[model samples]
Target: MAEAPSWFGEVERAAWDRFRAEIPWLTEADRVLVEVASTLRARLATDPAMSVNAIAQLRMCLSAMGATPADRSRVDIPQNDDDPLTCYFN
Candidate 1:
């Protein structure tokens, strides 16, 4: 298993949980980020010349997903007060 990016902090994690509870499609970006990272980690660990471009793509995707320099990236999944995820899923 690959280690999660060092950048993902408490705020990011909470944001993801919030996203999952609200807009379901937004979770795809998170999942894709992890999947791509895992693949890159494997290749980068073993192969040389694995093209920095791939890493750049990951960072771009991260930024598109609202990552910040502070590692406090948040997805901003707004939930209604009566949201099901905040209630039963808890």
Candidate 2:
């Protein structure tokens, strides 16, 4: 199995933590979103070309769960100058 991009774990964990903290009562939709995020994280590990799309979806889930960053500076997803997949964000 292919390993995830270096920043994947950190980003995923942060989102998961935020979700747990913000949503004490999860609806069925919330549960589905969580499951989708987990599935996407694993799939993105093997198919990085889909990182942008996966990240977008994850962001939507986070936003829906009210887990968006309170301060933009505090959100640190990976940004690699050399990797086109990540450099776009920078």
lDDT of 1 by residue, 1-90 (tens): 223346655445444454344334344436756445445545554567778897677566556545544433455644456765677666
Report per-prediction Cα RMSD to one decimal.
10.5, 14.5
Q: 1-90 in candidate 2: lDDT tens per residue?
A: 122224546656554454454554445555657655655655565566876777798677666555566533354433436777665654
Report how far off residue 14 is in candidate 1 (Å): 22
lDDT of 2: 0.56
- How many clashes in each structure? 0, 0
Q: Which candidate tops TM-score?
A: 2
Residue 51's C-alpha lDDT in candidate 1?
83
